[model samples]
Target chain A: MNHALVSLACHAYVVAALVYLVYLVRQMDALATGGRVLVGTGLALHAVALVGLFGAQGGRPVGVAQGFSTFAFLLLTIFLVVDVCYRKPVIGAFITPLAVAVLMPGLLLDPGHVMSPDVQRPLLPVHITIALLGVAASAVATGVAVMYLLMERQVKGKRFGLLFSRLPSLEFLDTLNRRLAVLGFIALSVTLVTGAFFSSAAPGFFWTWTSKQIATLVAWAVFAALVGARSFGGWRGRRVALLTMTGFCLLLVSFLSSYDFIHVGGGAH
Target chain B: MEFLCIGLSHRTAPLGVRERLALPEARQVELLQRLAQSPNEAFLVSTCNRVELYMAAPDMNRVRESAREELQQLGGPDALEHLYEHRGEDALVHLFRVAASLDSMVLGEAQILGQVKEAFEKGQGVGAVRGELTRVCAAAFGCAKRVRTETAIGRAATSMASAAVSLASKVFDGLKDKTVLLVGAGEMAELAARHLKQAGATKLLVANRTLARAEALAAEVGATARPYEELFTLLTAADVVVCSTASPVPIFTKENVGAVGKARKHRTLFMVDLAVPRDIAPEVGELDWVHAYDVDDIQKFVAENAAARAEEAQKAGVLVAQEVARFVRDRAVRNGVPVLAQLRQRGESIARAEVERTLAAIGDGLTDKQRKSVEAMARAIVNKLLHEPTARLRSVGPEHEGNRLAGAAAELFGLEEAAPPTGAGGPNVVANGGKG
Candidate 1:
């Protein structure tokens, strides 16, 4: 890709982030509308940059980069849809910042890592897709948990404000967290099972007592406990919110470490 | 203008007095017309618990006297002891609070707004509500909506429909296998039927005055539609009977319901009457297993909820008061607009007359074009002189001398007595001319 296009896409993402921040503070209808339009345009530019990278580098790098980029975009699309679907748009105040953070690094990060032809196979894309989807769901669950916690505090303290008016109730947020947790668990389970299946060695060999495997296992166990507790013991509300955040933090570590240790290919910067 | 709100509510009057003073739906137009006889903007809000006459008139004493007399036509002159009348700012604040649901028997209730809307429409039909009363009522509904949207006042609060189901649940141990008989296609009955369905009631039967209307509600609530004639048969088979209709006379009585209860082998029947003039006879409550409750019982339940949530109610009250103060402050400043406009016009006219006379005295040196320029310059000077004061008028507080100055201008220019400003009270004050 040309330097000019990447720089332009980078600038658009920054402007979109700042516009979304403005939406958080002012909540002016025009500002909110502008923020959405800017981000949408940035996504379009990002898509074009991905296509250009694919044309230059061939298919492998493009596939890997598109996997992460699609997950990020999917989360963002859900946030926008949820903002409009719910009468309260204040949740965007939380979600747009997370989106901005992801996009900022994504635009700057080098997607130039190459993979050996042997490592590039069908099972690898499947693993990456499932893991990224799990991360996205965990991210959503964490965001919902944070909102629920804030709203629950305000409602308990009886300090009602625009945020109190905007955020969903504790019950609703708890239910949403549980649902997202279930999705994350299912995706993570598929990713872990497929990665183990395609590793070319035995189970202990893939595990290898590595930090990436350990972090992945920890996140899986936490989410598993959350789902189990919710189903059997009816753990809910504040407890569920706390558990969801814990699992997301572990998943975040697992992803960053997996990228560092697994020597996976990168693409479409 | 002074405002007087006089009527019998569930708080001050018993069921008997409320019934006697209750304005039937058919007589709403006539009563509103009669209330308008005293040169007042009259509106009547008659719900099951409240039968209030809200009037705005220039003469407080005369309007209050006539309102009391009018109320006596139903309650025999003794109703005055139970009536409450508020005047001026207090009256204005009270109406705002009432419309905002703060003064509702059920705090933060949504039903009173509908009742207020119905009263406003009825008053409009009779040409009794105009000016301040119209403005106040409309403002009230707008304020109520704001409260509902802005506060947690509605969270876990039992609506009338839910309340009916709760009452039914109390009569029957569980509604899992029981049948609910919804009589009439009215809003309350439909809502109650939905609640019953939600509670896992095994079956539902809807009987209405018109079969088509019954069928519609039945389909919506997943209830079986039955003709009005099948009401007694349905009643015998059902565990709960929720009756709400626009019928003028009693639909269910001791004779009709007693036979049905007996035919069902004295099985328990929970009867809920949510009608205005009473659907079931008061005597039916005496039966051993026939647990009966009317709208008054619902009022009692709502009052209990209000009492339990009194602390929250106080918080809501603070919000309502704060909002009311903000609205009134904005309204008072806006009210200065027309007065300032008149004052500016008056000042300009005086300045123009003085400028023309001075220009005419120096006529020998002045060209026709120069005179026209001078006239234009003088008009600009007038605007420039008044601009600061006009802007200052908007920020003037009630305590400030600027308010007195504006008030004096209004009195002198007859703007004070002019028609109400366009949008004054409530958030959607635009709905009513702003006399709020």
Candidate 2:
């Protein structure tokens, strides 16, 4: 597998996201179409690039470097395909940036690395897949939730104009947010269960207390509260948006702070 | 052909002028007859907001002038300025939109189709509607129905009756136990009454000038029919009074309604005069404890309904354009029949005459079998000669060479000189003709 092509694929996605963002502002449908086409092409290239990397690594690349790259790229490809197929162009306003944000980190890091024992575990691939899908679903929920809040504000003030016009109605946005959150919640719970099971079986082998763990826990709590509020308290609209954004912020913290803490020689178990 | 539309609407004229122009059942028959006598196809569509006459004639300006003259003769020319006339396709579109309720005071109103149907039937009886006017009206009605079924325009976001009920709710806070007195037998009045009843009005009363008519309406609406003698007495006790009648004069004067308010100890009264020649006097609106609203007051709320349904109305416009294109194409084909027949006849005559002359000259040299073979060869030559032009003309549409071919062939064959072209028939005829 060419390391250069993987980097190129990630960079192409980022460029596509930027183009889509420009279209969101200019509202040029032609630019939007171009962005969609670029994203689609990038997704196909990214999928092939992952396959190449997997082939180079023997069978399934479930180790540290390859696992992260595969997880990030696979999640993004799935998200982009769903987003494009749904005919909801406005969603790109939120999702494209998120896609770039997740993929850029892995792209910047070393593409190839010697496989470690922790990375080559039996349950590693399943764990990464679950975690990646959970994160992707949460990202979508976060986007819809933000849109819901904006729409709710506009509705309350009765100042419906461009932002309000571009977004789905409060009812529709809230519904989407809730549904995505539920899916993400299920995936997160499965990942958590798998992680706990593997840690019990191979004690102290895959343990961590890095800044990443804390931030991920915080995200989980925020989303859990959101789901609970939705079911029991009937929390929706602006409230749901606030919770989603909070969870998303935690995700960013986990991604950034873990790298920082590890550089500062933080504990791994 | 002239596309003249004239009459009073809620916008240009007040209820008084509108009522004067409003054609009652008896007067509509006579007015329709008068319009038919003038060589124009007249269509009278009378709704609560408007009383418009859509006509088709050869001279549109002359038709417009005559429409004003007719209106003046019927309801006086002082109301002439309130009239509006749209010509040709504009008129056609306007009528289609109106029948579809896109141009209605309440957009996508279901009531308009029935009103149009009634107008069509009345015009048919008086012979004011024939040809294209009748077809356009019926098509417009059908188009309106399709728009209603296909789009969410008339899904009752808000209607005039609902608006009235909403206002009544604001006045009463809650409509429960309110007594409603409907002082007319018109469809609008009946609809308003039904809305009030749905809003939880306990008692309903109908008081018209004609007791039997009032009784008939009251029976249908589950209301009591009080005689005209007890009108003021009933008005005093009723919490709401909805007035919509075809009366020439004012039905509820300030003196009578004001006096009734005094007798009722100044209990608050919500009076909705849904009439054209306003049932309640304008001054009565200022009476103590009487909250009176005329048709004009309802315009803003009704306008919102129009705004809400604008998208669906736009869709209907597209449908109308599609239908119009189809209609014109069909008419062109039917009109080209004579031309096609004449061309075929002329070609056959030329082929038969030449063949006969040749055969006579060569009669001694040719046997019977050989003569038959020559006749067959001559027929094949005629078919080959006519095939290309006939195919080209048939393939041509109205927008392109079809009209040109028809006109050229007509002149070449002297068909127009022999017989004049007929008028455009009603939609039913066109639809059936198209089917054939």
User: What lDDT would each prediction earn against the true structure?
Assistant: 0.68, 0.69
Candidate number with greatest TM-score = 2
Give the backbone clash total of model 1: 2
**How high a TM-score does candidate 1 get?**
0.55
Clashing pairs in 1: B422-B434, B424-B434
Question: Model 2 over residues A150-250: C-alpha lDDT tens digits?
Answer: 76555443343566446654555766788888877787778777877766677674557766667777788888999998887656556677888788677
TM-score of each: 0.55, 0.55
Alpha-carbon deviation at A105 in model 2, angstroms = 56
The C-alpha stretches of model 2 lying farther than 4 A from their native spots are A1-269, B1-8, B11-16, B25-27, B37-40, B58-65, B75-80, B346-414, B418-436
lDDT of 2: 0.69
Off by over 4 Å in 1: A1-269, B34-40, B59-61, B125-138, B359-389, B398-405, B412-436
Give the alpha carbon lDDT tens digit for every residue of B146-238 in model 2.
788888887854356767776565446456677889998878878887888888887999998899989998988889999988888898789
